[model samples]
Structures are given as C-alpha cells and as structure tokens.
Target chain A: MTAHPDQTKAGAGRIVISVDAMGGDHGAATVVAGIAHSAKKNPDIGFILHGRRDELERLVAKRRHLADCTEIRDAPDVVSMDDKPSHVMRHGKGTSMWSALESVRNGEATVCVSCGNTGALMMMSVLRLRRLPGIYRPAIAVMWPSRNPQGFNVLLDGGADIRADAKDLMQYALMGTSYARNGFGVARPRIGLLNVGTEEHKGRAELREAHDLIAANAQTSDFEFVGFVEGRDLPGDTCDVIVTDGFTGNVALKTGEGTATMIAERLRDAFAYSPLSRLASVLAYTSLQRLKKRIDPRRVNGGVFLGLNGTVVKSHGAADPTGVSAAVKLAFQLAQSGFSQKLAARVASAALPPQDASSDDDGGTS
Target chain B: MTAHPDQTKAGAGRIVISVDAMGGDHGAATVVAGIAHSAKKNPDIGFILHGRRDELERLVAKRRHLADCTEIRDAPDVVSMDDKPSHVMRHGKGTSMWSALESVRNGEATVCVSCGNTGALMMMSVLRLRRLPGIYRPAIAVMWPSRNPQGFNVLLDGGADIRADAKDLMQYALMGTSYARNGFGVARPRIGLLNVGTEEHKGRAELREAHDLIAANAQTSDFEFVGFVEGRDLPGDTCDVIVTDGFTGNVALKTGEGTATMIAERLRDAFAYSPLSRLASVLAYTSLQRLKKRIDPRRVNGGVFLGLNGTVVKSHGAADPTGVSAAVKLAFQLAQSGFSQKLAARVASAALPPQDASSDDDGGTS
Candidate 1:
C-alpha cells in the first residue's frame, strides 16, 4: 500500500472496508468524499466501493488520494430509503447495498459500511453472511454518548427486528457485552436489562424471566449484570451496555436523538433571541462547540450488526461526509479487532439452550 | 368556597381536589406549599387534604389562607414509595392515598392528586374508583411539552399497566383523544399509534392490528387517525396524542426526560467552562432561563390516570411547589371540563368491543 504525504505510519496491518457508495441519501459523491476523509487520516485503510462504476470513478478521481486505495464494483441499482426488506430480498440483486455486503461475505473485505435502508440491509445481511452458529437472532448495536469513562454505552437491537423473547434478550446481553468489549475495549463490561423500573418485579413477564437468565450467566459470560435499568440510565455512568428488544431499543434511541435535537434547537433559538444573547453566543462560541462535541451524534455514527458471521456498520441514512467517516472509523476498528469472530465465540460459549421454545406469545405482540 | 383576600374572584363553581399530602418525598409541608401556591392563584379551588391531621394542620396554619379553604382528612398511615401495588391493595385502607382517592370516588371531590408509589396508586385507583364501564384497561396519560400549537401532546399509558393489547390500544386512542379535547381543547385532535416506524407494515403484529383498529374508529371517534408515529413524533406537531402500551410509553417518556436532563447539564457545563463564557452566561441569563422554561419537565408535571370512574392526577414524587401547582392546575381544569364523565361517554360510545380479549402477548414482554 502506497502512503500519501498526509499519512504518518502504516506498520499495523492493511484493513479493507466494503463501501456502499450509492445507497445513502447523498449520492456517490458524498460517500467518495467520506472515503477521501478516511484515506487522508489513515495509511492502512482500503475500500471496496460499490456503486455505478462511472459515477464512482468520477467522484474518486476528484479525490486523487482515494483513487489508489478504492476499488469500484459496478452495481448500478440503488436500494432506496423507502424499500421494504422483503421486497428487496427478492429484487435486491445488483444494488450497491447487496454488492457491499457480498464483499464481506466473499472475504474481499473484513468489515462493510452502508448508509442505506436498515431493514433491507438486515434482510440482505442475514441472507448473504447468515447468522453465527447457534445464534437465535442478529442484533444491531450502536454506541450511545454517555457519562461513562469510555464516553459511550452500547445499546443493541436498535430496530434489527421488533420481536425478542427472554432468550433473545439474554443473547442481546451477551452480544452487547461482546460489542462493548471488542468495539469499545471495555473489559468485562456491565450489562443492563432495560425496563420501566429497576425492580425485579417490574416490567413485562418475559423481562423478569430474561433478567434471571442474564444474571445466571453473568459469571460464565464474564460480565457484570447490573440487573434492570430504566430509560434514564441509558446515558448515565452506571452501566456500560443496555440490552432490550428491538422495538423498545429503537424507540429509546430515536427518543433520545429527538430530545437532543430539540434541546439543541431550543438552545440555538435562545442564543439568537436577542442582540445581547447573540453577543453572548459569540463570546461563548468555543464553549458551546465543546458542549456540542460532547453530545454530538456524529461522533458515534455507526450501528454495527453483531451476531452475524461478518460485521456490517449501518451509518445514518442522512449522514454527511463527517458522519460517514465516523462510521468508517468504527468499521476499521472493529475489523482490526476481528469483532465478528470473537462475538460469535462469546455467544456460542455462554448462551443457554432456548427454553420451552413455544415463547410467551403475548409478550412481544401485546 | 370562601374567598381569601389573596384571591381575586369566585364567580365560577367551586372545585374540590383531593390531595394525598403525606406520600410525597418532601412530606406534607411541600404539599401544603403547593396548595398555597394554587390557592393564591385561584379563588374557586378547594382541597380535601389527606394526611395525619396534626401535621397537616401545622403546615396549613403556616399558610393562613389555606387553612380556611382546606379540609383535613386524617388517614394516619402513609404509603411509602417502595410499597408494591399488590401489598398496598391488601392493607391500604387507612393510608392517606386511600383517603384521597375515596374523596374523589365519593361525591366530595371533583378530582384527586397524589405523589405516592405509582403502582400502589394505580392499584388503589382501579380498586377504589373502578374502571369506567366499557373500558377494559385503565391508563395514565401525561402531557408532554411538544411542537404542537397547544404546546403539548398526550401520551399513555405512562405505566398504569405494563401490558396493553390491540383493543386496549384502541381504548387508549379514544381515551387519549378525550384527554386532549377536554384537557387541552385540541378540537378534532390527531391521534397516532406509537411504533418503530411509520410504515404500514412496520412494528409488531399487535401494532398493525392496533393501527387498523385505531384507524377504523377515528371517524366515529371524532379524531383524525394519523396512522403510525415514531418516537420522534411524540414531541413533534404531527400529532396531539400518542397511544401505546404501558411499557413503551413509560420507557419513551423517561428516555426523553433523561436526554433533556443530559443536554441541560452539558449546557451548564459549557457555560461554566471558562472566564469569558462565565461573562457570556451573565449576559444571556434571561434568554437561557427562557430556553430552560420551554423544556422544563416541571412545567408539564402531572400524569392523569384515565378510563377510571374518577380522575386522578399523579404528581412527580419529587415535585416542588411549582410542579405541584402545575399538577393542581391540570386537575382543576379537568374537573371544570367534566373530563371524566365526558371520557366515559366517549369510550362507551366509540370504543370497539373487546376483540378476542385474549391478547398477543409477545409485544410488551419482548
């Protein structure tokens, strides 16, 4: 691998990441720009960029540094944000999202990144790479900005599939812990079961059943089971990982994001309210920026699919170049640590056999 | 009702609000102070204060005007915050919470307020007041500060029960709509079922069934069915009422609250970072206060238990004088509008007959 003048060192190891260049809200150009940003910062990263060949070529050629490190695979079709997961499964061939995941499945790339349809990506991912052996479900784990020493917490099943049983939650606990350990380098991370209250008797019946299952495996799973945690604990310093079904996790994630956005906007409107406030904002610019950086969603952009045979990082669909690059950075780090294999091994070693298997039916559907 | 010199007018009919003064975290003095604040603001409001008579008298005596308008009902026992609902139900006859509810259950008080154990209060409420006819599951609806013209949205069941089926969701729709129309005067309010996504096929099977159930009843129910709404829409102007099972609603509510708290703390840290920013803080004080007031949870501080025979407003256990007064105001407005009776009528006339009654359980538990 040739190092650009901007690069400092490359002795670690070359890591190639598959990129879906066309599926993002922004076109291939913005994705290429993100690749350029990543390339400029690191000397050991390569990309298997998937999109329309001519368009990707034009975009990559503009960023002269990215051209040598990037490979363009011609998958002309784009999987739109509105595409259904089932519909995409049947007609999703030759799309950028499909091509990118294929690279990871076919051993052309260790990790893949896409700012595309989350549901469709999950569908295609399960189809291409399949689940890790003995895994009951595959979940997407995202890094949440928190007051923890690591500055983030891992929250899983961020809408991968809406349903999870007591057994599924136990797997999330294991998978989320694995993600925290490998993705964030948290040694023996603390795991929490998300509930309305932290009490043993609170929440739905399955949550109570899952709580016992997760706690029973804490010693063997090699992580601290913090028991039940409420929604407020998501950003608190108490726990390193929060595990819940996809529906609740997804709602909590969006609720947190929406609240943050509303607060930020309210703050902006406050600073812009009067001439005096405007002057204050100018004087407090760097401090405000410091706070923004502390809570910024872009700083933690990727939702990595865990329990799959290969790793795939789903960036926000409307992500800018900076957001895309943040996701790429996460992808590179996970690939470097061989997160997928370690996560699979963790699940296989610690997971309990599925109980009854009939499931508490009213649990997810009620 | 006797008009204190501090009060301005007494032309409107008298409103008697039953208050469980002893159960709040700060004790009866804070409850008295909150009552005093409310009493000072209006002349037509009366309170049936439940607690140890001696203790209540001492606090009410401090606010001389409150002594004239408040009636003390000695219940001696207090329901501690940690007491389980089942335990409370078995041995709660003499508690202040029970006495307060009794006042509302009887014809003495138009509405009730309490800051006790939520589960205990919920259990006692269903036991004492009973469910309104035709209503299967009782819910707690709280007003959320939002981008709507009304400046708020109604969300339920704020943890009244952890489980709600499709029919319960439909009842919540009508009940939430009734709450909106009576409490906030949002005519022909838009009702939305909270889900992971707004897509027709997204979320759990129960949610889809709920979507159809809710949508089918909207025209007859006199509210616009906005279909499925994501967590972001909880605070958006896209809807005035968001309906979901107890678990999701509670989690989303707390998640939003936690996010707001996190952001506010970060903003404070930002302003206190440096000497220049400290000066900027002084200059921006009023605007900052304005922004703070806009998002403050205390400003919208009551969770109203709906679909019950009588209205019960649960104030935050830690609420100060302002928070208590806000809740008192809601109870008063609800009483004035005959909200409970109107809600009963709405549910009886518009609610779909309980379908199957056997639920899809996997949802909330999952």
Candidate 2:
C-alpha cells in the first residue's frame, strides 16, 4: 500500500501506539504480552505502555522478550469500569486511560488502545484530544459478527451518544463509509440505517428526516444505500455498515455478546450429558472443532471509536492474550490506513450545500 | 395440583386449547405432531386446531392416535410474520391466528397458542380477549435461559409495548412475579429491573421512578427485589424475573437468537478446519453434547403473554415438533395456574391505598 503524499512527507515507517496497560480483566500482563507479540512481527511499530511503573515492570519482567519493544509511561491511577463518565472526565487525570489518550493528543502516539471503561475512554478522548473540527459527536464503531467469510458488518455509534438528530445520523453514515473503505478495504460499503421497517415513514420522526438526508446527499450517493435493516439482519451480512443511536446500539452489542457466551456455555452443557450422545459428539469431533474456531471471540477483539480526531480502539474487558494480540493488530492496521483522517475528510466534504440546507431548515423547530 | 374453585365448577380436566394449526414454518404438520405428542402425555389437554379444512384433515390423519384428544376448527388465512400488526388486525378476522385467539374469547378454549406474527398475536389478543380490568397493557412474559437448575427467569413485556411508564413497569413486575410463582412453581421469585447499572439513578428517568415504585410497594416489595441487572445477567441466573420496555426487550431477544445461530454456524466451521483440533473435540465429546442439550431452543419454546385477561402463549415461528410440544405444555400449565386472576387481584389490591395515587401528582414539581 502506498502512503498518501501528505502523510509520506510527515514521517516514514513510523507509527506510535499508546496502550492502557492498566485496563481489562487480564490487566497489564496480557497487554504487555500482546505488545511483545505484535512488536516481534512488526518491527516498524513502536509502543508506549501507560500504567503504574511498578505493576507494568513486574508484568514486563515476566515477559523478557517484550523488553526492547516497549517503554512504560507512569500513570498512578486506574479507572474502574463502574465509574461514571462525567466523574472520570473531571477526576481521571494521570490515570492510564487518560494518559494514554493524552499521548495521542501530543502526537507522541498515532493511536490509543484500551479495554477499560468505554464511557471513560470516550469522555477523556473528547475532553483531551477533542473532536475533529465540524464533527458533532464521536461514534463507537463495532464489527457485527456475520455469516460471510469476508467477516462482519460495521456498526457506528454503538454506545457513544444517547440522542442524535438527522444530521448526526448522516454524519455517522459518512464516517462509517470512510472507515469501511480504509479499515476493512471495502471499495464501496453498503450503508443501512437501522429502523423498525424499510418504509420512509416507519420509525420516529428523526429517522424519516435522516432517511431523506441520506437519500439526497450526492457524496453518500456514491456508496450503496440499502434503505433500512431490522435487528435480525445484523448478523446476516445484509449490509456492510449499520447505524443507530447509542442506546439501541449498546443494547444490541451487549445482547450479541451475552448470547454468544450463552450458546457456548449451552454447547458445553449439551456435550456433557450422556454416553451415547458423547459417542456421537466424538464421531462429529472434526465438525465441532471447526465450529469452535469460527465462533471464537478471541478472533475479533478491538472495536474502533470512529469519527474521532485520532485512532482509539476499545478492546473487550474480558479479552485474553490472544484477543489482546488481535486488538493490537487491528489498531496497527487502522493506524497504517490513516482511517481517522480519511473519515474526517469524507464527513467534512459531505456537508449539505448551504442553499439546499436552508430550504428545509428546522434549527428552531424542535 | 388441585383444580381451582372456578375450574372445578366448570369441570375437572376440561381445559380446551385453541392452536393455530396453519401457522409456523412447518405449517399444519408440526402443530398436529405437537398436539399428538402433548395428548399422549396429557389426558386432560384437548385441542382445537384452527386452519383450512383440507390441510388440517391431512395433518390429523397423520396423528390418528390423538383422535380422541384433538379436533379441528376451520379458518381461512394465516398471518405471515412479516405482515404489519395493524394490517393483520384490520384484515385477520378469518385467519387461523385470529380464529385461535377468538376461541378463548368465545369460551370454546381456555387458552390460545400460536406460532405466527407475534405483533398480530398481541394485537388480536388485546382486541378480542381484552385486558383484565384496570390493566393498562398486556406484557409478553418469557422464561429466561438461566444457568441454574431452578429453570429460567421470567422476563415481561418482551416486545409488546414500545413505551412504558413507571406504573406500567410496576405492573410488569407484579405480573411477572405471579407468572413465576404460579406457572413455574417458584415460591418467591426474585424480581429485577434491567438497567445499565445497579445504582438508583443509573437508567432513564422512567426507570429511576419505576425502581422506587417497586421498592415502595407493599405487595411487590414482598417478593425478592434485587435492584438491577445488566444484559449479561440474563443468562447467568442472577435474577428470577427481569422487566423492560418492549423495544429493548425485542431487540435483546432477537439479538440473542441471532447470536446463538451465529455461534452454531461458527462451531460447525471450527470443526471442519484441521485434524488435531478435531481430535481434541473427540476427547471432549461428552461435554459438547451436554452443552447442546442445555442451550437447545426447542426445550424452551413457550413464551407467555402476561397481564392479559386470559392465558395466551406464543410458539416460535420456526419451531419444529419438539418446540411446539413444549409450547403446548406451557399453555396448559399457564391455564391451570390461574396466574392472570392472581395478578389482577394483586394489582387491584396494591392500588387500593390513596397514598399511592398522590405520588404522580407532584410530577410537574420536578
């Protein structure tokens, strides 16, 4: 892949990543391990593991192979997942999550990755790194587990903001499309607004307006607009990108995660029951092994917080070493593709024409 | 179990079930097979399968052993899952789904079960069966797939109503509790409100108010009032009953279903990959069978629509014979339990105090 002329002039084979070593269930050990794994494979990548020096030192000591690849930046405090976003923003200075985000703000790092409190990460990113000019809100983008070999569907605003208007939804579409092109390498991503139905008048009034905005946009029109998709279509690869409010998106993401865990648990329970069935399971062992590899959560780890000024990927809190490694890989690819810059540019260019915008102005209508 | 006073007066073992024979993915065949399966085990249960004459006749011929236990009632159309709820309500008079619901209203059956359009089922039941006096809206109750041997948690309003106030949420708690005690035979079911957090002010304003209502109520407070639960807790047996709005509940349910299907597909893919992993699967065969049985959707098919005037159960649209059979059994248990009457009494008695009436009067003060 060729680097953009503008980016090529800025740097050569240089990509800095800031990882929140204090974040996630597995803590700094997994993050350090992941960093070591990625560094060995990609020598061009450099990393700053932000956390308490003593804790990170202990973990790094256990993994001597990662010694030369990583540098530790001291962050005294660690943010808990249960803490409120507002509280975190006000009081979380010097914490690993905040400090890591700050690394990106100062250009010390090109990207930030964490498996900590998502709300806190977003809050700190917005407060410190700030939003890209002309962008209203940052959207949390997630890949919906799909049936296709090409992998999953990308959903935006998975849980960033509570309520969004038509313009915000349109912005999500543009940002998501850009990310799909850069990150997933989809030439022309099919975007779908999540709604109760496909009819123009189906959902709440905001949806109807958003539908019109998407349909009328010349910039977005270049990509496939598949109208609307239902909740069931999420895992079926019906569209490359799905967009919705944070409330719905959060619930959908949690529901998907919970369901996956439940099924795995259930499958385990089913195979443990009887001797004959156990024998049958043995006969079908090859098929079962194939199934486990396909559905493993470790294969899909990091979810990008799209529409931000810089790259910020959120790994699952429960992610293990394998999952953490995948997250590092994902972050590296996203950084290399310059996904953040591309998304910002696409959304800015997609702004409605001033004259056409005034024709249906509702600035004071609500 | 002893028969209720009213049921005894009517006749012991005379509960009639109206089944939507032409509904579901397998059409009349699975319905007939389910009826036959239930009839062989339950002498007290009787069926009235509603569908076109010829199709019903052919199905009945295949289940001739159940000749004494089952009978058919003619109906013309079948409501498709994709049909709008309002459209079906306006034009579903002669349809199998509508006719089955009507049988319960006409006293030809004590309970109704259909594997058709869920929205239409709720609409027709509300329109024909009507709500119990003073009950605002009917709730669709479900047995959550719990981790314990205590069976499942009861979740109410599983996509029946879009918006629910604090009062409606309280009623959902009451109805869900009653269903758990009477239907599932749990002495004191633990009730929980689904929320993002356990704190009092965590969720939307309505949920905060609802939490107070549940805690303050004398009747509802008698049941175990575990504060709040997240999506992950649903399958972990954290609470016996969970309450939420229809939109969130519906999305969660569909998301869970989709995830399960995706995992199954993924597991198949995993097993087909290589030899060593296949050998590992063979060694773990017994555990796999146990897992499958525990998570089998067929074993947990019947989902009850609570807060209605009478017993109404919904079978999965894609359910086969085993799933439909489980639904039939659930319908019978619900009818025998007199859960609706108990819920009505509890809710009515809980509202007798005038102090409860003044709580909402100060709404504008906030």
Candidate 3:
C-alpha cells in the first residue's frame, strides 16, 4: 500500500475521511448525518461512506445538501460487534469496515473511522496498513473523562494485547506521550503506570520491570514519568497519560463508561418518578446540563488506536450524529497534526538495546 | 504452629472477634464504639481489642458498658498503612495487627478482623496461619453490591495474587463458589467469570483454560455456570458469584466504591449550595435515608479471604462504627457456619487422583 496525497475534485481541502457506514447500532444513518453536519460546519472536509449501495443511497437521499460533500462505495458485508476478530478478517472481503480501512491504507483518505467491533477494526487496520517497524503490537489509546477538560488521561491497549510485557508497556508510554503532545498539544506529558499503589516495586512483576525500564530509558526522560497511579487517580487529572495491559485498561474504561451511563439513567428515572420531581428537574435544568456536559461521552467519542502506521479512530457504537461528528473532527485533528509520525519517531528513539531488553521481558505473564 | 482449638477459656457460647483497635484512622474509639454497639444488639458476641496500653485504657474507660463484652490486650507497636508489607512483617512482632491475628491463630478468638494495611495483613496471615493443604495462593473474596438484597456477587483475589494463571483462576472459582454457598446460604451458587464477552474464547489464555477446567470438574459442575459477565452486570444481580484475578478485581471494586462516593459527594455539594435546596434536602430526608440504605457499604463491610484453612475477614480502612459492627457479625457468621471445613472436604474429594496424592507439594506452578 502506497500513501497517495490526493486533492478532492470538489475543491474541498485535500483531506478525506473514510467512514465505515455500516458499523455501529445506528448504521449508515448516523455516519451520513454526522458527515453532512461536519461538512456543513467545516466546508473543507469531505467523506467517503462505505456500505451497501441501497441503504447508503436511501440515507443520502434524505439529505439533499450532502450530495456534493459525500460519496458512497459499495461494500455489502457488515461486521457485527459480537463477531470474532479473525472471523471478521477472513470473511469481510468487501465489507464496509474493510473498504474503509483500505481507503486509508491506499491513501484515498487521510484517516479511517469506525464504530464497529473494536478488536476487528484493530486487527484489520494493523493487517491492512501494517505496523510501523519495531512496533510489535499496535495499541488503542483512549482519553478518559477527567475533572479538568483541559487535561485528560491517555490509556492504551484498551482491548488489544491480553498479556503485555515491560517492553510493550514502555512502547505504550512512548506512543501515548507522543499522542498527548502532538494531538492534544500537551507539553511533556506526565506518564504513569496503572497499579494498586504508587510506591516502587508495588505492582505485578511486569509493572515492576516496566517501572525500572521507563525510569532508565533516556529517550523517555523528555516526558515526565510520574510513577504508579490507582483507578481513582484516572479521573482526577493526576497524570496526562496512564498505561496498562489491554485487559485491565478495557475493564476500567468500560466500568467508567457504564457507571456514568448508569448514573444518568438513574437520574432520569428519578426525575420521572413524580410531578413534583419533574418540576424540580425543570427548575434545575441549568445545573443538570452542566452535570451532563461533565459526564457526556459525546464530548469524548474518539479513541485512537495509537502505534499503528495509519490513523484509525473508534467512535462509540451508540453515538448519535453529534458524537460521530466530534469523532470525525478528532480524527482529522490527529491525522493533520502528524501524531502517528511523531509517535513513530519517539518510539524509534526510545528503543532499548537487545542486551538491556532481557531484564525487562517477564514472559508476558499477566 | 499447631492449630489450637482452645487457647482461651470459652466465655459463654459467644464468638470472639479479635480487632486491631489501632488499625484505622479513627483508632480505638471507633473500634470500642463498634464493639459496644454490636454487643448491645447481639449479646452472644465478644471482642478482644489490641492496641497500645494508654490509648486502649483511655478509650475503654469512656465506654463502661463495653467492659462486660470487650477486653483490651496491649501491644507496643502500630503498623501504619503506608509501611511496606515485607518490612512490616519482618518488624511487626508486637504490633496491634500482629497481636490480633495471633489471637485468632492461638484460638483465643474465633476470627480476626482488621481495617489496616491489606498487604501486611495478607502476608502476616499467610505466614502465621499457613495455606490450606492444596492451596497455592490464598485469595480475598468480596461481596459486590447487587440489585437484590439477598443476592451478592463474589469477587476473588481482590488484591492478593497479582500474577495468576489458569490454576489460580480455577481455585478462585472453587473457593468463591464455596463461600457463596456457605456464607450467602445459596444451595448451589451460580459462578460467572468476569470477562469482556460471553464467547468461549473471549478472555486471555488463562481465563479460556480456567473456563474449560471449571466446566470439566465435577465439584464446579454442581454449581451453575453462567458464563462471562461484564462490569455493568455487577450491580444487576446477573450472577451469584463473579471471579477474576486480583489486579482487575481490586480496580473494579475500588472504582465502584470511589465512583459511588464521588456521585454522592457531588449531590451533597449541589444541595448545600443554596438555602432553598438545603430545605428541600431536609424535607426529603426520609427518602434520602432510604437511598442511603440501598447503597450503604456498611451493609457489606467484611471481605472474606477464601482458600485459607480458617475464616479471615478484612474490613475497610475508612469504615465507621456501623461498618465495623457489620464486619464482626459477618466474621461470626462465617465461623459458625463451618464454611471453610466443608469447602476443604469438597475440594479434596473433587481433585483428580494424582492431585489428591500430591496435594502437599507446595511449590508447584499453577
């Protein structure tokens, strides 16, 4: 696959985002609406929607103004969220996700966005675009909801590698730091290893080894190593970046997300319980909106799979048009900012010598 | 290190819970108050409080009614929560926590409960009590908050084994199941492995293997296997028992506790901001109390560390008198039920022929 820098014939700025239209619960309607909304706001952006021709046409026909900014490519197969990663890759020949990812690989689009099976999207992206040299496993980096919107924590391998060694953890730190710096414009991002305690030699064997490797690495010295952080610290803006194996990270991320949603649902149910409560809810509309904005997943929809050669953003499966639009904007920001290129350089520089590597390998025994 | 069934004279048919009175933030005062409160309600319960001579006498003098049910044992040192686990064990001979556990080990008390440094407690307990004949690593089993009052989920290895393989997971399942059946009085507990998905091959290699082993083993087969469960299912009473390694389990448990507290704090702050809101809160005091009862951590304070030869419960460090009282009651219930003995018999009988013969081998890798 070659990187081709192409200019759109429609006279929009040369960047194009290939979206898996058939992905997520809402399917093509959400992607089409989100694209139309984003294109109207940012006239420089264009989209290539990949899905079944009939459904794509029907969704597009509902929005006449989007005809100029949007185009559809036929990709009949759809990958469900429950599908196995290998199954998706093996059977998803002309699937929307496959085509969307291929568009990024072929440089027809600057970035690819999907709200499909996260594992499948990750596998397909790494398989299609290939990993950057020395990057054994690509990581999925997410911005967790924090008390300070200006400072969000980055967590990688959200569901990628089951068991990661110290070397993988170091790579995650490097990639996550580079992402925070380039994508979010944070300077000298403070990196932390997620553990039960902050003390040295506190966590599992791999974390202990990773701690030593991170402390000794000269290249990572440019970024701040803030030692260990607990689960409570993730929401407090204690560190700009926190790294862990995919299993723990995924559980923590999902737990946070589910808890937020559960609380919101409970509040809604509480308000609907009585007429007096409903009136009080109306009276407290402003305060409620402030709370909503604080916990809104839409405000943090895009989760970038860092360490991959090409840019791939995974949005929430249940995201509406607004969330999808935000995801697209975030993807564009990451791609245009050259986040991947910067991360590649940082990881290359941080690579440890083979002799020193022996001390860090814990046999991936998580 | 012989197991002494009678180290102290039986003072009535009551169960004595040895408490490290100097363990938590509130010190001997809270422990004395909790013991007094529990003793007032349950005349059959007694407490052996361990702490410094001066502080113990000072606190005990204030509560005259406690003299009938409580006895103070002086210990020279106090183990700070921040102290390293290994260092604390090496130098904790006369510490309050050490003395408390010693009381249980010598059969002076039926159970030992602490709200102190968890790592130090685990180290001391394992060193003093020793593991069960076949048990490799002891696991901490906690009751996860569920929708049904009678239905509570068990999470094992809550912060014990940082690195666990298939065998560890299997042991956690077996031990947790036994706890649910004995502690919760469930006829046959339904066990669910905490994983990202319900598919057979969803989790890491260890989980996959553990799932197969549990399905094949007759001891585990008696209990209903509900398959995989996510973090969201924890509060919904989807399973009778939930199992995972310590690292993930600890994070999930703490995250739930912290998030719930954070939300409650936010609500209180919101209500306290205005006189009118404060008045409204006052008017809704009864309803608020009901809500508090629904989510009270005090209702579930004691977390039993299963896979041991005897019952040992770890209480929350921040627990109040009410929480401490609940922990003491729970410890008494576990001992009276004879859960650990029955569990040992079941585990021994269900093991493979070779496993039964070689059960004494200590260093075998799981």
Clashes of each: 12, 32, 0
TM-scores of all models?
Answer: 0.90, 0.86, 0.86
User: Order of candidates by DockQ, top first?
Assistant: 1, 2, 3
State which candidate, 1 or 3, has the greater TM-score. 1
Q: Model 2 in CAPRI terms: which quality? A: acceptable
Candidate with top DockQ is: 1
Q: Report clash pairs, candidate 3.
A: none
Off by over 4 Å in 2: A1-14, A23-30, A40-42, A195-219, A269-290, A351-366, B1-14, B22-30, B40-43, B77-83, B87-92, B197-201, B218-220, B269-290, B349-366
Model 3 reproduces what portion of true contacts?
A: 0.21
**CA lDDT for candidate 3:** 0.74
For every candidate in turn, the CA RMSD to the true structure comes to 5.3, 5.1, 4.8
Better of 1 and 2 by lDDT: 1
For model 2 the interface RMSD, in Å, equals: 4.2
Candidate 2: deviation at residue B5, Å?
14
